[model samples]
Target: MKTRNPLPIVRLAVAIAAAIGSCLPLARCAAEPAVRPPNVLVFLVDDLGYMDIGANNPDCFYETPHIDAFADSAMRFTDGYAANPVCSPTRYSLMTGRYPSRVDATNFFSGKRAGKFRPAPLNDKMPLEEMTLAEMLKTKGYATCFAGKWHLGPDEEYYPQNQGFDVNYGGWTRGGPYTGKRYFSPFENPQLQPDSPPGDHLPDRLARDTAQFIDSHRDQPFLACLSFYSVHTPLMGRPDLVEKYEAKASRIVGEEFAREEQVLGDKPRRVRILQKHAVYAAMVEAMDEAVGKVLQQLDDSGVRDNTIVVFTSDNGGLSTSEGSPTSNLPLRGGKGWVYEGGIREPWIIRYPGITQAGAVESTPICSVDLLPTVAASVGYELQHDVDGVDIGPLLHGESLADRDLFWHYPHYSNQGGIPSGAIRHGDFKLIERYEDGRVHLYNLSDDIGEQNDLASEQPEKVDQLRDRLHAWYQRVDAKFLQAKPDGPEPWRP
Candidate 1:
């Protein structure tokens, strides 16, 4: 008999050993699980009004097809509001999941414009000790990135990187894109490099950077915050787009586009009775286009199904002043007042498999609720105190327990708003002017414009709301404007 080859026996033995190693329960494998955590994208727009989007206002002069389409597939919060009626404080609430009053960030930072009452000692920078939404998400292994306006603090240490973001594109202290060359290339922003081609728009550049981040982190969970500085001040748009809107405006009937004046506080504020501003309309369309680009990138990457998208604004539109670009018609004050128009925002959220598509929730929600909602969506538990309640159930078509929403603005607004505090419980709202102790009460369900003041008629209701508001102020240790030792003159910047 021929001798069996020992080499063949050795090869078979090695193959068997390798198979066993591969099948071992404790051994690591080359292939990972197909499932991954959902990515989060927050599209934050600055100075966008409640009625600007077609989804919210069918009569809007500006076209926002992309936003309206997104709303069709998302849950729209009809009564959504910013934490404060300004940029920095509302942004603080978004990042911390707490009322801005709790941290003494009650107004736009560095707002030196004084009024009859001295603006409550302003906290110019967001406190570093407070845990931000990004920091909490990072603990759960989410790659955090921020691109856009970050007016939370005044220094570099208070920027996005220091606030828990792994990467920051153009976040800085300035609320608007007033740096570099305004909204074009060669930006003077210290955090962002001027790498785009000449004459490149800031919003488009921001969207591109954000899309690149999403592309690079497709395989992992990420939080991409795209905050647009468009439609704010220094209203500028592409020449072609401005012409397009101007032509559209010219076609409208004379009665359709008219200007009106309303006496707010002690001054006559000119309100844009209609949305006919050509430059403003162009800015809005450009912003919508940028949003479309980002959403398209998400779809092209094949990760749209596994992403959670949120669209909102820092505050109401600029109507009373600063070009008086847009109208918040039925909502009362804009930007810095305590009226419905000032704090109300467009809140749209899309979470695949969780939120019901094309649903509407009229329950009032605030920016403070964003953090807790995002944390719960990812199955993470928060360990610290939060003023916002988790509205996850609301997304699934379940009702949340009724609660109150509050706002405190002790400084005068550039848009001609007085120092005021407000509280909303159910359909009734109360506003307290700080200069004097005068209170105004309105039944929002009956008078959404806040034109009818029922405080004098309903004394008991006013007393009840005033007491509760004061009690809350004590609970949060809210700061207030102090009386000037000497009779103070009307404050001007």
Candidate 2:
């Protein structure tokens, strides 16, 4: 009659057995590792500012409920950075896990369009030699897909199909569909006649194709890179959505939405205002909805727990047309400069058991780190040299040692910015301008706004940072012009 206590002992044994079962596989795998690859979903937004989402900046013009919720459900990195200050270069570093200058494709391509200020860029594709995170995951038998924008390289020779993605859609437009020729139209504009629209709306099409890819690949481990092109330039928004934002913008302006701007190519004064601020805000809202759809599909497919979802942007928020008047106030310059706003982005990583939700990590992590981090997560070892270290440890609440991060933007930008290179060593940052050979140094911990130029007073600090930047350039074989013949000495401390 007293033998009923077997229930307690039985439960204890079961718990022990379960623990051993989990540990045993990991031990066995370490000896002869079978891949421990988890599904990866990278939701990349374009031209998203540091303060765009409510989780990052509650007072942003647009309300991104989905993005804010996702950030809350994930581990957010406050000091996350993009490799470059501008789009194409930032993306080059993102996909290749190396600096864009290394690839020698740091500028935007114009699809054979020639003009005074614009020069023909080297081929747009991320060279075949570079290994992409998507490609690396394929080694572990993972299904790969890329949706949204792909401004990496030229098509045919360097399309997503060749870059380790099993499926890709709506990614290969030159510059932007809205600004480019008929071939790149945003809507069923002049370009729809021949190539079949990338879809009704660029973001919608990317989202739809992405959902389909997940549905088809749910049975297996997958690496989905869903890069949304919403919020970028050429603000040709969906008509219904445009009307919604038009009312919002009109109320803010205390006037009706300018009909002149809506007339298509009318080039009114209000045209820049509507396209840049109003359409940009609407695009962000659309991108947020698109992300929600993909996340919903993952849940419905029964793979939410086993997937690692990363949300980030290519670069800082675009400060010009199609962007909100949000403040990177303290962050200094916007896109195309060596300031916080241009290169800083919101980074969130969600992995069920491995990472804690609603956590914020202040360690500096950049897009280049994604390669090694994802590689390690998927149980793959990287043999080649990677500029960015694995940030997986930081995401898991480990103490990250101090390290220096550097950036180089060699080309000129149309956004009223000069060529600059910056080096971040701990709390201090040194920015050097190639045009005037000026150095502006700031202790970022004290001045996130970059208001004071301490270089004048701190000669020792300036020399130290300059030495580090030059050494790094030499080590990486970075591309830089040998100061133009007529220009003054471009190298200065």
Predicted model with the maximum lDDT: 1
Q: CA lDDT, every prediction? A: 0.88, 0.71
lDDT of 1 by residue, 368-418 (tens): 999999988888898898889899998999999999999988887888776
Worst 10 residues of 1 by lDDT: 255-264
lDDT of 2 by residue, 42-90 (tens): 9888878787787888656676898888888889988899988777777
- RMSD from true fold, candidate 2: 7.2
lDDT, candidate 2, equals 0.71
Residue pairs that clash (backbone atoms under 3 angstroms), model 2 = 124-152, 124-153, 125-153, 125-154, 177-184, 276-322, 330-449
**For this target, which candidate reaches the highest TM-score against the unseen true structure?**
1
Off by over 4 Å in 1: 1-35, 254-265, 488-493
Q: How close is candidate 2 to the true structure, as a TM-score?
A: 0.82
Q: Each prediction's TM-score against the native?
A: 0.90, 0.82
